[model samples]
Structures are given as C-alpha cells and as structure tokens.
Target: MLYTPAPLHIPDGFLSILVSVVCWAITIIVIGFAISKTNKALGEKQIPLMGVMAAFIFAAQMINFPVAGGTSGHLLGGALAAIVLGPWAGMLVMTAVIAVQALLFQDGGLLVMGANILNMGLVTAAIGYGLYRSVAGQSKTVKLTVVGIAAWLSVMAGALLTSLQLWLSGTSQLEIVIPAMLGVHALIGLGEALITVFALAFIIQTRPDLIGEGSESAKASRNWVFAGGIVSLLVVLLSPLASADPDGLERVAKDLGFLSVGQDAPYQVIPDYTVPFLGETALSTILAGVVGILVVGVIIVLIARGMKAKS
Candidate 1:
C-alpha cells in the first residue's frame, strides 16, 4: 500500500513549538525562492495555475477511501499536480494546498508549515518530477502508465521524507514508523496513481495541447483547469465518504503505538471544520471543499494576474 507512513500531516504534539516555528520559517524562505523561480520560467501566468492546482488538490482530499481497517484519507495530489504543471509550478501549487489545509482544514498544524511544505510540496514536486523525466523522458506512448507510476512513486517519496523528518525529530522509532509508513502508503499510492492517471488521460484526450510547450512552461489546460475547479467544487458539493480505516500513516503509527508517545493536543480552531451551514461530520468536509476551492481560485487568479501569466 503506502510507500510511506501515515504522514498527511503530523498530528498535534509530535513536533515542538520551536520545531513548528522553524518549519514555517523554512516554508517562507522556500516560497520566496519558488516564486522567483516560477517567474523566471513562464513569467507570472504560472502563478494562477498554482492556486488552481491547490484548490483542485484540496477538493480531491475531501474524497477519502477505505483502507484495510476502516480508516480513511484523501489524495495528496503532489505527483498529479507536478506531472500536470511540471515541478516548478507543482511545488508552488502544493505549497498553496498545504498552507490552506493548515489554515482552514487544520489537517496540518500551522506551526509545522515548513516541514509540511517540504514534505508534500518540494519532495513530491521536485523528486517525483525528476524521476518521471529521468525514467520516461518524453515517451508519450506509455505516458499514462508512466505518470501513474510517477504519481505512486511521488507519494511514496513524500511519505518517506515525512517519516525521515519524524525520525530526525526523534518523535518515534524510525524502524517502526518507516515500514509502517511505506507499506500503507504503497496502497495509498495506488489511489494516487489511479486519480492522476485518469485525470491526465482525460486531459490528454480533450486537450493535449495543454501540456508542456517546451520544457515545463505553459502546462495548463482549459478543461483540466476547469475540471480541477469543477471537480474540487464537486467534492465540496458532494458527500465524500472518507474511509474510516486509519490511513497508511495513521495505521502504521497506531500499529506501532506512536500515539502513546505522540500527544493529541487541542486545536486553536475548534470544530476544525467550522464552515457555515455544515455540521460536525462529513458535511463540513463538503463546506471546507467549497470554501477552499473558491479561496484558492481567488488566490490563483491574483497570482496569475500579478505575474501577468497566461491561462
């Protein structure tokens, strides 16, 4: 299943406040570099796609699946976003997604923003992309399968990095967490692959032109961008049956009893899902999805506009 452990985000108390603050600092630094780097490539137009991808991926996360034991989690979309937009834009988009999830969903702590961004954003966008280009370089024939594999590998890589970070923090035994993380993530990676492949396949069919123009510039599609917006909106509107089975990371952490050492602290934001008109359960997820989508859409438009980037 998962190539990595249950690392959607380190639950509360796993990291210290100092560690959390450091993480945010790192995120800020990396983002500065990321923005500059993106501007260098396709100008500012690429910025909007970052926001668009974030909304799309955030919405996708709303739909959870059943793992082995009834625990559930949603797609990270790092690989999918990277593959679609290329690494540079992918990192930016992923950063946006993670940031919003931290702020709104409270899925990941605000304090650990840096570590979270690096784990999900840079790792998935950069590492996964490097592997894809290296292995499948321009092979349009097997692009779907290749991308499927890439998405799987990307999730695995992200999870592995997360596990490593946890290990570095000395939060838990890496020996226990690493295998648990990888095994569960391997399965979860399958879901990631399917989603990415299907989405890419659809894009290829309807608007192949939306892909890269040369290197990784202008890798935006009207349908996919719209589909991303629409699908995310759909996830917001629909009642996503998030699986109850502990996600790969959570499963491993539980199996190893990481929870024993890892404390579950109270959140600053109660009812993490406090969207208007949404209850405490699944409907909140829908409300979060919709609000997240619209917020991200506005952010994307603003970024693109600022960058003077094209759609």
Candidate 2:
C-alpha cells in the first residue's frame, strides 16, 4: 500500500474561529502590501523566475526527509525563494505554493490557511530577506553561511508562530507547546538550512545573475527555464521515495495530545496527494505531484505577468 503522508501544515479546527479570522485579516493586509511592492519592482525575467521558484518549492515540499525520533521534515523554501526572488515576490511564490497545497492536494486546512500562509510564507520571506540583505556584497562562503542561518531561523519562526496560534486558540499551554514545538523543529530546521544552502550554492555557481539586485536586468533565458522545469519534474518523480514518517508539526501535535483536534477537509480534490482513480499507488502520487507543480507554476506565472502588465 502507498504511504499516506501526514499533514505538513495546520489542519482545520486547530485554531479557534476568532484566531483564524484575525490571522486572515493580518495575512490579507500583508499580502496586499506584497503585491503592491512586487508590482513596482517585478522585472520581466522575474515573472518566469517566480513560476520556476514556486514549482520547485512545491515539488520539494512533497519529499519528507527523516529526522531524529521518528519525525520527518521538509523544505519550507521561504529563504531560498526570498534569496532568489526578493521578499515581495518570494511571498507571492510561497503564497501560490501553500494555496495550491491546500486547495488541490488538501495538504493543509482551509480554515487555518491564513495562518499557514502568514507563518510559512509572509513571515519566512521577511525573515529570510531581512537577514540575507545584510550580506549583499559578501563572498559565496559568507553568503551561504548567512543563508543557512536565515533558513533555519525561518523554520524556527514558523514553529514559534504556530505554537502561539495554537496557544491563543486554547489548544495548548504556552510554556509546554512552545518548547515542544521548538525542540523538534530545531532539528527539522537543519534540514531546511542544508537544502537551502546547497540550492543557493548551485545557483550562485552556475547562474549568479539569477539572484541579487542584478537579477532585475538579467535577460530571460530559455535554457534556465527549461532546466528548472526538468528539476521540478525530477523531484516529482522521486515523491514515491519520501520517508513515511510523521512531520515535525504532526509529531508535536500527537505528543501534546492535540492530534485529534485536526479536522478533515470538507472536500477532496486529489486528497493526500493521491489521484483518486489510481487508488493510492506510487504512480498516483507522482501524477498528482506533477499536476500540483504545473498548476502552481502556471498560477504564479499568470499572477506575476498580470502584475508586470499593471506596473
């Protein structure tokens, strides 16, 4: 039987309606600002770059690597996105990825999506870019070091925010939840850092112009776009090999006795990343992942192009 991956994000009923609403309000405001900022600065090449980044991030999130104590972790990709696309565009890319996960794959809950987007997308991008901008003219070694730190901190920030939301929702006490969430995520964050560092290192070595302020004037290259598409497809093809272990949040929730609080999605599209007709086979997962990347990539590209046109 195909392994059913545990929910990688906050599911429905994890937060009270009031907290969820508040998060929604905050997220909408931040996303509005991001759109305005990106509209003013988005370059022609960056439009397709946004799509490629979103596709890669979406594909990367599908494969969960094992961590200590039977828990697993996946790339959040905010740092990498921000480092490559700038924070505003990075936020947009992350928003597209997370939205697709919830709406298409039911990987995250609809009710808590605002918090998810805020924690995993907006905040991460901000932290990543904020820290990274300090080392703009540094060497590759220094840049990678900062990126790794930023990536790890981004994961910690997401965990901390999630813990707070859960506490505010009365799901757990602040003291207990904070430590539990932070402790496991600390290890998970290492994986995030390493993956981000390696990816950035590759980009820096091969296509240095694709990152930094220089990217604005970097001419669009079909070769880069095609290579990125192939990489995303390859990641999807490897989805079947992902570790069958509970993710950091799921592990923490189960340990804290709030695992039962997670509510099922009201509907299913390709629920749990498996094609319904295929009945939970590895091929089903690969196909579903392919569909997911394609949809998210197209959505982000369209949104970016629209913003570019407006600008």
Candidate maximizing lDDT: 2
For candidate 2, lDDT tens digit of each residue in 1-311? 12233333888878877678778899999899888877777668867878887998877776677767876666779888877877778899999998887887777789889999988887777667755654556677987897888888778777777876786576876557766776777787898998899888998889977675544332332222232333233322322222222253354444333333332222421244332233345345457657977986786466445634543
- Span of ten consecutive residues with least summed lDDT in model 1: 235-244
lDDT of 1: 0.61
* lDDT, candidate 2, at 213: 52
lDDT of 2: 0.68
Q: How close is candidate 2 to the true structure, as a TM-score?
A: 0.65
Give the CA lDDT, 0 to 100, for residue 158 in model 1.
63
Q: State in Å the error of residue 32, model 1.
A: 2.6
Candidate 1 lDDT, 1-311, residue by residue in tens: 21223355876567755455656677688678767767887766656756777788777766666756777645778877777787667878888877776776677776577888877787666544644443333456566776777677667666666665565455756557666777778788888887777877888789988865356333333222332333223322321111222253354444443333333332532445233333354455556557976886787556445534431
CA lDDT, candidate 1, residue 136: 36
